[model samples]
Target: MFINMASPERPVSNGKRDMEIDKYGFTGGDQYTFPGVPGELPAETVRKRETKWLVMLDNWNIWMAKRFPQLKKRCRKGIPSSLRGRAWQLLCGSRPLEAQSNQSFQDLVSSTIPETATEDIEKDLHRQFPFHEMFCQRGGAGQQDLRDVLHAYVAYNPKDGYCQGQAPVAAVLLMHMPAKDAFWCMTAILTYYISGYYSQGLEVIQVDGLIMQSLLRKVCPLAHKHMEKLNISPMLYCTEWFMCIFARTLPWPSVLRLWDMFFCEGVKVLFRCGLVLLRASLGNVASLPIIPDTYETMEKLRKLDKNDMHPEFLMHAIITLRITENDLENEHRLQMKITKKKGNSSVKLVKRVYRYAPTLQHHGIVQKTGATKHLSSVSVDSSQVAKQTQATLPQKDKLHNDAVTLTVYRPISQSSITTLSSSHTSNQQSEGPNKDFQLKNDVDQAKGTYL
Candidate 1:
């Protein structure tokens, strides 16, 4: 049993699993056992990444069909390791950023040399998915390179500054690209698909969420309810996901899959992906032993596997959602309805204000619109002032100016003229009232003049 020194027929260890290889190469012990060691960053994962990346590439539509005849098959199966960077660039529609015509890529990269970037990049440097081995190096090259590129990008787009969610997405990109190319690709992603999800003021992101919610309510009422029930509102989870394009939640390969679709489809694809996730988990969600809470809802949704994520079905659902009966009917019916009600109310209001316009005419105040609306009865000082103006101004002139000024004045508060002439004015002076007028006209007029 211990004759290894002389024996040619000794058993040897196979690479990953601890299976045996006898004199002849054959896996003998538990052929499929996992290794004791945790996984490491593999040497050449580009092919796998490419194949996954292509899943989202989709058929040639208006944007990609003719030029990308080969994109479909090429991305799905895999890409060669060395070629992945170039392939990924083409896939994400960053062809423009990486365009041979990229007049400013180096200019932009050179601009990243500022001292401010060194600190910001350093802050996010180790913070991004540092636990992953590819991101680690004794020399710290992995993290260093990624941070440098993204920091360059933040310097690159001063408008965006640096957001927390962009790092993981940047790391994934760095895996397959040089720093500059990765930075530009990130640019394309934020500019195109991210909408306003990561903006500095975050108002665009707020509007984008409203848009997403409107889209969701139209397409997936059940999933929308689940989110509302758990208060796992889009505001919470989506901030990071949309900001980073699901980089943290999805594996790198899946991230590629999502981006391929995003590049081809647009922001609408994100909502479709949401629907797909919900549909995928609908069964688990429905079958849950208890009414699902927020975490429960997400856990169920998280269980979604791409195994049966039929792209065709998802695409159909997204495109069809726009063609609604209400949306198609007469096109302007809703606008007309709102306009008609507004019009009728204005007529009644003008008549009421005309009755009071004469009384206020001495003050050079006049009511505008089909009916007139003098100052509300509550503010006697303002009403008296209005009356004095109406009296000084000619009758015709006061009405005309009232129409013009009110058109540009405080928004009409009540839908009806009745409320306009009523005692609705509160005496409390409004905050910033003077500032608003200052901004309204670049040229300030004399206090009492009608010019």
Candidate 2:
């Protein structure tokens, strides 16, 4: 399963063909040369590193068999770069090449005709890793490989199409493994780790931001309060962090460590990492050179040096954080409910806008009950406004019965207003605060951690 590229003379093969696996992988016939490179790995260096890799892989298998916790603890230390590709495959449970043929991917790429997504895929190709040599040159081997992987994915799932954030993710994957393996890893990320993230509406990413906001309030109340007072939405800074899995924000080494834990643990790692970043930045953000806007804040976050984010320190801090798996599950549940309710309202609004708005604008009256009736005022209740506002809030704040004030600047018809007020009264009477905001368990859990 191991392809030795220790010596230039050693011809690497994938069993089916005689190929030399270069830094990226086998590129048909060429040696796949880079701009500035060494002749070959020193014999001693190769032996030492490869021996360590083999021994580590063997130990991983043994621990995996026993379902031991030590394996995770060891993985937290970091996977060696030499074995990172294979280790990632093992983590995601990817099948061997012999069992899963590449012919299918080849055929799909060759046979599938370019459709609507062709333009999108082409535009994002060079934008992936412009600084890196592999992807620097236009139409270079790396860029071509990136295009193939993305196009194949587009054909694989046409409905989802192509998303911008996925390019960097795929590019990082390509750095570690071949195109096919990278494609599978991308699939695993989309399907299992972060479902609905790239889908239309990006519903999951939005919910995750709200969840982060909720967690931040508990983890760093002062920082959260500062951000809230400043009117900084979680969507401002966290969108890129969540969408790209911190690929665009953190240093490469730190991102690798986070990914290592993410694959082993799950989405909870992302929450922990977000909390860590905010916690680290709390003092700096609270004082001196105060962040001006979202752009400056994000730029400052991205520029955080390795000293501020040493892998061992960050990982240790993340593990020791009060956040837990159950907390994430509860936040996810709360966010899902809120997102669904909003989604339904949006759908209804879209339907109404398209079907009735144009006609309403043109004519002042409408036919109702087989008679022409003049449009009247729309009345909204005070309590109804409170319910709507509370629903949009995070779970932590939704339970409090805070009085809300609503201002209406525009005129509304009396009939519509009465109908709205009646509906609100009925809703207020029928639904209790506990039904929508019953989160005693979450409150108790947060108290245990926050106190």
Candidate 3:
């Protein structure tokens, strides 16, 4: 149902829906506002996405939780097929509001300047179940909806600009939702669910593979070991599953059903689902026995599309797979402990020994040493100085500070020289008494250990 935004002065459309609008009253990107309730069309006019099943390991969820006690209780149930889009939108917290709902997304999409729209959308556009009516229906309202949703997201987060994988997500959403509705879901998925993933630069999306590997290590150590032996991490096998949320890798219905769990649960669902796959294929992975090269391991795993991964069957496989509670808690606790330990270690190592490392030159360490008394003083640097003591310290330890120069300070006597110049001789004789006294004092200071 649509929320009615129109006041009495605003005219509602009385004719059938079409591509263009007669009234600028509801026109956007112009100097006007529309009068009418932005209501949802009746259910009769809406369409369903094309879907099929591949994996059917029945009772997979129950089996997984039972096998591994570490899994959290899913308070939220999976969304029904009919409401998957709405549920996903709700899950991502990206739904549109009445006053300003979807306006920014729509405005941004309309204004985006793409380098080449045809190749960008076309390359992966038809690849996603092109035979399906919902996605393949060219120039149809359905296609427009998918385009709007995808384009809006690309515009909203231009950094991730656009990628080939998003089509399947949008196409899948379109099959089950309106363009605007799917846009809301896309925002939620991109913002809250996979916020960093779809950016043009793909830095965050790439980072996720790293995080997934960490999770794998905890949940399935043995499986993780096998992957590491191959020197392959989640970067190798899991990127596509995440990129499309398993649209291409898993069957359509299987993905939709999985998404139901995903929206209700969040990303942990993806991890748990992945665990099921690893456990089910453990025998296959071990038998293949590949390792030490990430690409090689990946090549072996890519052949995992067994072509018969039905939902019920995977459900069955996961249910039977053995995962333990001790394993889950130990995994989570291990990561949490490591995180805390690293934070503490950094503070200790960077702690200041003196008031400032650079400001030490201004302190008493340099000014008090006797010139002849093994006179090496610590150069206090003040930059690393701490506020508590405000002390400047030398770079080396206390023992080395004074002993460095004592070994070279032996005084040599001036040899008796008979210069024939009488005037210069008198000048030298006058300065000799004061110079001798200074040298004697310096020598005495060194003998007395006055440093």
Candidate 4:
């Protein structure tokens, strides 16, 4: 499946016969090239890393449970390319989610989805990584798989449906694995990692822009002042960077390297990268020459210097940044408070969307009665209810003594919660505050670890 860059019959031309492609399948063109584009790792180093990754993959549960920090460290270094797809699935806990689902990828793809979603997905197919061999052809296998993955996702989460930004993200996943696995990995990403970014109002991303601005003010005051003076919003420069997960923003090598850390470390990596880019472009006095005007500044942000963006240098800079998960969370809370004070309706919607945390139970994927439908619920560990809620009964009426209640159960091996059928029995009450606290902790842990 490798691109043959040295083939003589396929002349190196700017036309359709262009044979020059990079190891990552980037076409030979100035647009894809950058100064100091990193070279491939040495054979021995790659081999050693791959071997270590194989061992880690073999004992994934143990590593995730007891040696998570060590695993995070290795992920920051970089994942071996050959094992990256599997590593991503394991890292995000997508495999178990995929396995526990009642619906198969085929079923999802075949089921009915919105026509608008399908049309939007179709339009974006050829646009994503079109220069790469995998998706170069208009109606090729790559495009077809991209279609299925997007279609299935639309079917799976119809509320958010499809966004143009997701095409590039899914296309990148397809480059690493099959459509099914890519779908689940994308599911984990959209459901947990960057949940609200693509929703209708895009409230979360808007709040994040403010958070990034706040971080910039602390970390790089000069850049912050410069942007403020120019009347430039963070969203003006960073929307594509955050929305596409940098797929279209960074060079190919740096994009992959960033994703390696991003999937493991969660969305903080994005904030760090954004801060670094701001600092690199405008923090110093010398940067004035490159960005003398608003237009030039926007251009500079879009097309960063190749040497600065080299995978090794970019990753080093990202690692050195002082931002942390707690920083992001704290800043997010501050932004939300400010937004709430302003009476922004979107903030209320964001709060509601995040309250339940978008687990399997929130999606109604698992049922109480243990009945299954196409892409429906699976009953696992029938004895343990993960969540329960009961309506208060009116004391005056004996007929209204039976309270309506809802119960959700947890799977034995995975972290998702499932819902139970409503019961009108008088004794069907919530599991009390202690059990509710424990269930919330479990859901929080699942969200935190996966992200």
Candidate 5:
């Protein structure tokens, strides 16, 4: 007997099914949609760029050392999507950290983390790029990967634990690369580029917000006046923009482009982009009618027109703005001074802990433990150098213990080598057999010689 079984009708209401999905998997016809405009570079241009980028990747250390300006120019143009993951890793100096780390990503992910962080991460997994195919499905690979990366970060950096904003940033990174690479890139960013931003007090971000306001006052006085008149503090609007690194706020193409420059140039790109956004939204007289009050102003900021955010337009705007690193540094110093005068002890501690030095870690001078130490290239006085070398020697072979004075020879130029040799010979002859030690010639062509 055939049963009259009927399948339940699928509910339909919105135009979701008709929405266009872009090549990158973002759904169109809504706020989450990728821009419909042709914002990407031409195919030919992209191929050329990819070739150049591959060459740059091969000589990354050399390019970073000698041809930084050219490298910066290319990065500002945009990294090709295929190579972006590796480019970002190189730009932020994460690849070395990954190699140097004592604990692996798997180790961190398998280890236990705080229940609070785990719960928070679980809650936010589906929310990051929910419209995108990768993360759209519950318990999918994307969501699982996102969960693992965030969980590992909490285990890796217990001090910061996990911030809600980091999920989206990690989600973006995971979209480009594997969870392991994403974790290290996220570590470099959190450790150096925007340290203290996600710490308990959110103090560094607060200082940056103040810096943003000061920048706006100079770059777009009209916008600054409007915001100040309405008493719309930057923290009210910019916290999410800065915190998520604009992963949530900007169009996908613009986000990628901004990040390209950001990794190459450091956090100043963020400030420049923020200034551009503020000027676009609130600086114009025409914008005032649309964004009259704080609520409307915030709405405008949150839901910026995609056309304005298209990479070509947005990047052009960001580039035209003449803000410099010095400007950002000056503003940061000014804001911190004001904060210090206010006697906010907690904020003061934040300043001390997260003092802004964007390049400190990128050059490998700062370690994962948050300690600041000098690299081999840093110069030391002869006395200190002697003391260090003496400390390394065996106690029984210690010159200090024998009451014999030791001379530490500095690296000398090739032209001065002969003079130093002659002086050493004369000293040996004058001091007789007691000074018969042979001089070691270790020539470091770049810096000098060490004996």
Candidate 6:
């Protein structure tokens, strides 16, 4: 029997026949249905873009070198869905890690994870993208692939382990690439693009939130004062937006467009996108009838006008804000300085127990208790680079050391998905601000800078 996973409606049955469902939630029967009207951008225009991207992608090494500025400019417009996997791999510099990491993923997925981590991953599998056909099944291929990605990630970076926001990010990567490639892309995103986001204490994530609040005040002072009046904190809405890279906040197309620029331009895109949302939602946030619940205010962001949520509109709004790359860099430095001072004031404690991967024997899973790992490698920015650093774990309750097993029958859902469009919107499809993407001839020629 086939079930319609996209909607909550009941399944229709034909007692004499077997029902089959396709990925987009359509029945496999050969019935023709009229398509919805095309958006402002026509199909031919999108196809032309897809062709242009594919040509550049086919010659990536040369294209990225000679036309780095061009690639950046086009990526701001958005990547075509068909070319997104390759485009992202190129943008994030994940290709070199693919061969090495694919073997690592294979080795880890076949082995047992810490009983706790395994339970956590299984619980989140269906919840990652329940509405999408790929993950709706109880133990379907999508869930299994999602499980493999999360499990491999924990094994690869046990220090970071599995965090709540990582699931949605992983799920989106899987939608574009093979599981192994997705793993590499996700690794680069965490370590290089947004370091400390998923780390314990989430200090960097909080710091980024402060930076957003600073930007909000400058670009939309009225909204900023209003939020301050009501005690609306950036952590309340901005954490999920940054942690998941806006996956839960914007529509799928908009998310892709933001990602395209994010990979090319780095974390600044996230800040720009966050500021745009705060500015757009100013009235909704300010006019709250009473003290607001965090989720209630967030739901307001989730339900932004379809037009405003469109990637083109959001990007236009983002570019109009007069913040510069230097402005963000200065703010980031200040936030980091404040964060380090705060960290120094607190006592650092280490937990003797490794809660994620120690005991498979007790669960009747025949893995050795003596399984050891070399320190998992991660790439950090040059300034913060160190010869060696141990994972800074937070002080936790002793109860976590106790042995316990769990059975996760139902998949736990993650955050909500936005309905914004980043695809095929001619109005929002123009190149970003000219100055932001302009390439200097000297810098372009400089070694290690172009790539």
Displacement of residue 450 (Cα, Å) in model 4 is: 30
For all candidates in order, the CA lDDT equals 0.43, 0.54, 0.42, 0.64, 0.65, 0.56
lDDT of 6 by residue, 252-282 (tens): 6577788887777667678888888877776
Q: Report the CA-based lDDT of candidate 5 relative to the real structure.
A: 0.65
Candidate 1 lDDT, 1-451, residue by residue in tens? 0101111112225553223322212232211212232332254565565454455333212113122334433433335445556655554445533443334666665664556646666666665554344453433878767866776676667776776667767877886777777887777666544534455655444334433444344445565655555555445444555666665544444455555545433444565565555544543444544546766655554444544343344444444444221221112232224334445332111100101111111122332332223222111122343444444344444233333221111111111112223212212111122221121121122111000
Name the runs in model 1 displaced over 4 angstroms: 1-83, 91-95, 98-120, 282-285, 288-291, 298-451
The digit string of per-residue lDDT tens for model 4 on 82-138 reads 999988876665765676688899999999987888887887787777678888889
Instruction: Report the candidate with higher TM-score, 1 versus 6.
Output: 6
Which sections of candidate 2 miss by over 4 Å?
A: 1-53, 56-61, 96-103, 111-114, 283-289, 292-299, 337-451
**What's the CA error at residue 248 for candidate 1, in Å?**
1.0
Distance (Å) between predicted and true CA of 355, model 4?
14
- Give the clashing pairs for model 2: 376-413, 377-412, 377-413, 377-414, 378-413, 378-416, 378-417, 379-417
lDDT of 3 by residue, 305-349 (tens): 453355656644543333322222233334334434445332111
* Lowest-sum lDDT 10-residue window in model 2: 351-360
- What is the model-wide C-alpha lDDT for candidate 4? 0.64
Task: Tell me the TM-score of model 2.
Answer: 0.63
Residue-by-residue lDDT tens digits, candidate 2, 175-198: 888988887777656654665667
Supply candidate 2's per-residue lDDT for 101. Answer: 38
TM-score, candidate number 6: 0.67
Kindly provide the TM-score of model 1 when superposed on the true structure, using C-alpha atoms: 0.50
| TM-score for all models, in order of appearance | 0.50, 0.63, 0.50, 0.74, 0.74, 0.67
Score candidate 6 by lDDT: 0.56
Query: Taking the tens digit of each residue's C-alpha lDDT, what string does model 5 give over 177-246?
Result: 9999999999878865677788887777767777788768777889888888788767777778778888
**Residue 32 of model 3: what lDDT?**
22
Provide the lDDT at 89 for model 5: 84
